[model samples]
Each structure stands twice: as structure tokens, then as C-alpha cells.
Target: MSDLLANLPGRHLEAWHYTDLKALKSFAFAAPAPAAIDSALLPDLAMNRIVFVNGFLDEALSVLPAWARLSSHEATKSDLPLAILNAQHRQAGIAIDIPDDVDAGAILLISISQAGAPIALFPRHRISLGRNAKLTLIDIAQGEGVYWHNPVSEISLADAAQLSHYRLQDEAEAAFHTATIFADIAASAAYESFSLVLGGQLSRAEFHARLGGAGADIHLNAAQLLAGTQHADFTSVVSHDAPHCASRQTVKSVLAGHSRGVFQGRIEVARAAQKTDGYQMNQALLLSPHAEIDSKPELEIFADDVKCSHGATIGALDPEQIFYLRSRGIPEPEARAMLIRAFIDEALAPVTHDQARALLERAIEGAWSKLVS
Candidate 1:
């Protein structure tokens, strides 16, 4: 840690601490550039909405349904980590709410601008789903140059509520991003999340979910494609505290060029969580000698009669599979790409949007071509 970082308390740390201090000091520090929004960035989606551009709330572009509420607050007032960064800088993000008993859909749009400056920005969001309410959230992040973006999202679920969240990150070479999402689940509530990391210099998304009531259910799945010198990390922690609760997670990544990838997952079943069912799996593909991947999956069960399992695999393209395709007259590069695609298809199976999955597959195929050629 630099003297600047050591002197700055985590809460009182300066904006430079929000990102790599060395990078910011070595380079000319520039204020974050504004992210421009395209007209109709989101078509008439069924859900209520909150929009943030360049980490700042854009009320004019947000659509607050009659059943929903949204606002931006000083970080010190909330449990979120924003205060740790905000105490030293301005609040660059916003908060969101969905009242109980409201049959509404909600989406929060987060975007980055095309400005050619390395920068750092923070965003904070909070959501609550009332009894029996249903919500769908779509979050997107993109940028132009090398920059750092750190975001935190917190959610609370009431009895019988359901939440579906989708996240996409597609940034340029100079971009680095880290995001953390925390959720509290009520009895019989459900939380399903799907995330995609397609581009960035360094990107990591952390998810923590806890069952606060009996019989809660949670499902999380993520896929990442790393090319060039880009890197990505997907970390998750799931805890089952109530009896009969269930949780499952599957994460996958493809590493090419000199890129690196990481996946760390943990599932914990408390003593009271009897009859819990927890499962986790992580798999990776390395397409080049210089590409690297690391995975760690763990299960801690204190309850008797609970079923839990965790597994991880890291490997390169299977030569036998590649030969089979090459023997069919396909070029070596194409054959290898096909095999790797098949290996990763299972990770994308849960994606609800066909178009999004297709776009991701196309991106993966393009990455393979670049790596092999």
C-alpha cells in the first residue's frame, strides 16, 4: 500500500483509493467523463426503471412506475460500501425501491461513456420486493477506454416474492470493473440471476445470498469470455440458514490470449438448515499457452441429512475432439473453436434470452478465431 493508501482510512480513503492508486498517480488524474444515453436506451419494458449514466443518477431518463420508488442518498446513511468511498468523494450512484404487493417489473440501467480517459466511478443500488411481488432487472455496462468502475447492489425479498436479474458487461481495453451484490431472502422467496462478462481489462463480480427464512430458493449462473490481455473473476457466497432451503450455482469462463480468469464459490448450510440441497460447479477453457484460470469451489454443511456437492475443472481444447472435427474437413482453428463452444454450451443453458445467448456465442467464436489465428 502506498503512503496515500495507508494514511487514508478505508472509509476516509480518497477517490484514488477506489481504484489502483499507482495507476491513477502515474497517469494524469482526470475527473470521470459523462456517459451519454441513446434515445430509448430501453424499449417499453414491463418493469419500473432507474437509470444511471457514468455512475450518477439520471432522473430524467428513469421511469418510476406507480408501484415503485427510487432515490440517491449519501453513502454514510446506508449499509452499503458506498459510504466507504463516498466519505472521501461525491456519491456517484443512486438507490431504488419496489414496495410490497405491487405487480410490477423493474430494471436498472448502468452505463459507461465513450470518453477517452482512464477514470474511477462508484454506483450503489438497493431493491426490495414485497410479498408475492414479481420483478425483472436488466443491468448493462460499457465504456470506451481504460477506467475503473466499482458498484454495490443490495436486495431484500419478502415472503413468496420473485426476482430475476440479468447483468451484462462489455467494456473497452482500458476498462476495469468490480461489482458486489447482496440479497436477503424470505420464506419461499426466489432469487435468480444471470451475468455475462464479455469485455474488460480486469472485471470481477461478487454475489452473496443468504436465506433469512425457511424454504427459500436461490439460483445463480454466470458466463465470461476473456480475450487479449483481459481478465475476469466471478466470486459467490451462498448461505442456507433455514430448514428445507435450496441453492444452486454454475459458473463458466473461456480464457484466450494472455488473459486470466478466476472463480471462487462457497455454499454453507447451517445447523438449522436441515434438508438443505446445495450444489455448485465451475468450469474453464484455456485456448492459449499463456492463458490461465483458477477455480475454487467449497461446501460447508453443519446440518445432518443435507446434500451438498462442489466441483471444478480447468483444461485446454481436447485434441481428440479437435481431430474428429478436422477429419471432417473443417479447418483446425474452426474445429477447435467448435469443441470449446460445445464445452461451454451447458453454462449458457439457463439464459432466458435467446438473442443474448446468441450474441455471447458469437463473441466467443470471434475470440477463438483471434486466439488460434
Candidate 2:
């Protein structure tokens, strides 16, 4: 554990260049101690609920859906430093499996942290879907106090399976969060994920996905709402190893005050990955002069017959649009908020799940209020 912590990536690594971990060295974060659970942290949904208090799975509070089955498993070792840390400190985790042709309704997985001092929680989860299975997973992370929430999730989909995954991170203002998601998509499978990040003092969400079979489709989309001096980084790497696979990514950020937002997206196409289609775009709207956004979109293609493209844009609210709104009796703050919402709505258009989309929309509205105030 000490060696892994010593080798934590810093600004030296290109992947971690925009977001450095040097500040973490100054704080001594012990393993999170068990605390009283708060039911308010759980969303008021009738679907299956899985609660993890400080990284340990709470079977007493978890309510499994009819199509979902829970089991125990050992954590997988990884070369990544954060993954290694999670594997070492993780206490209890959940492994869920969905049978073929089952449409598992909304399943909520909540991770809550309540610690007195600087602490850390490493929670691990795995989801596997059989052939032709479909499921929707809503992952929420919230907490109070100064702590670190480090979570790792592994997902796999069989041939023709489909999974819609949504994640919301609204941690405490003083919290630090680092999350990693690794997904392996099979032939003809469809995997879609949308993430809304609105909290944490300094947060970084990293996603790495591999298209392991032909005709597979994957979409990775995210929105970040930041205020004050908060920093949020969304990094992703999508690898296409099979032919006829399609991948798309769209990331949007709304920054206020002195907050900083970073988007690093990479798409890789192997030599044999012919007929692969990949698209990525990132756009940011800054609400204050001191706000900043750093976007890096890269595509590495070794195949000849593949269509891949990437683009990024950063700017403030359009003065003309804001003026038009203000002329119609809308206040300056309300006009700005309206424009910001419209800008972000473009990236969120692809989300199809009703419940998930509504949740993200609400988060965006709340974020807009904070940004304008």
C-alpha cells in the first residue's frame, strides 16, 4: 500500500498532466470507519437499492430487483495505481448478474461517506449481463466531511446485451473523489453511460472501455457543473479492437467563479479494426472571467477504412443571445442560465432513459442556479 501510494501519478504523466495528485501527499487519510447510515442519502426510488457505507456493501439495506442476483467475488488486480489502491483497501463489494432477456428496471447503487477526519473509502462493484439482457444502473455518490471516495467498477456485456449506466457525483465541498470504470463490450452489444459531476473539492473520473467484438456500439457522455474553486476532470479512453464497432462521446462543462474543468478524451483503433466509426466533441461555457477549461481530444487510428473525428470548443455566453433574452424582460442571470442550459442540452440529447434523463436535467438546473448566484 505504501509503495502504491508513493507511485501515485503526478503531473509528469501525460494522462494526469491537467490534474495532479501532489496535494494528496500532505494529508494522511485513514481507512474510513463505519458510521451511522442516513436514509436520506438514498434516492426515493422504488427500484432495487444497493447501499455502500464507506465502501462496505450493506446487505441489510440493499433491495435487489427480481432480475438481479447478488454474489461475492474477489477484486481483480490492475496495473493502475488507483486500482491497486482500491483492491488493497476495499472491504466488501457487490457482484450482480442479470439473466438473458431480462429487463432489469432501474437499479440504484449509492455510496455514502461520513467520517470525522480525513478518511478514504475504496468500493468495488461488478455488473455482468447475459446475452440479450438489458439493464439500467444509476450510481450515486454523496457524503459529508473531508474524505476521499475512490471507487472502481467493472462491467461486461455478452453478445446482444444492452446496458444503460448513469452516474451522479455530488459529494461534500471538501471531499476528494477519484473513480475508474473499466468496461468490456461484446459483439452486437450496446453500452451507454452518462455522468453528471457537480461536487468535490477536486474530482477526477476516468473511464476506459474496450470494444471486444464486432458490431458493438458504445457511447460515453458527461456534463460537469462547477463553482467556486472546485476542479473536475473527465478523462476517457475508448479502444476499438473489432471491426464494425461504433463509439461516440460528447462532454460539456459549465464553469463559474474560479472553477476549473478538464476533458481528456482518446479513441484508439487497432490495425484490424476496419469500418470503425468514432466521434468525440467537447465544449465548455465559462460564466466568469477567472474560470478555465482545458480540453484534449485525441484519435489514434491504425486502420485504413475507419471514420474517426474529434473537436473541442470553449467560449463564454454569446452576448447577442443574452441581449435578445434580456430585451424580452429576462434578467441577466436568468438569461445567462437559459443560454447555458440550452448549450448543455445538446450534449444530453442522446440520453433515452426517462428517469435517468430527468435526474440529469434536475442536476443541471440546480447547477445553473449555483452558477448564476
The root-mean-square deviation over C-alpha atoms between each candidate and the true structure, in angstroms, is: 4.6, 1.7
Point to the candidate with the largest lDDT.
2
Worst 10 residues of 2 by lDDT: 64-73
Candidate lDDT (C-alpha), each? 0.71, 0.86
lDDT per residue for candidate 1 within 230-303, as digits (tens), equals: 77878788999998888888887888888888887889889999999898888888887898887877788888
Candidate 1 to truth, TM: 0.83
Model 2 stretches astray by more than 4 angstroms: 1-4, 66-72
lDDT of 2 by residue, 1-373 (tens): 3443586787888998899777777677887776768676576677788888877667778886665444446777777788888887775666778998887777888888886888888778889999999988988898888888888889999999999988999898989899999999999999998888999999999998999999999989888989999999999999999999999999999999999999999999999899999999899989899999999999999999999988998898889998999999999999988888888776675678787788777777777678988
Candidate 1: worst 10 consecutive residues by lDDT? 1-10
Error of 1 at 30 (Å): 4.6
TM-score, one value per model: 0.83, 0.95
- What clash count goes with each model? 4, 0
lDDT of the structure predicted as candidate 2: 0.86
For TM-score, the strongest prediction is 2
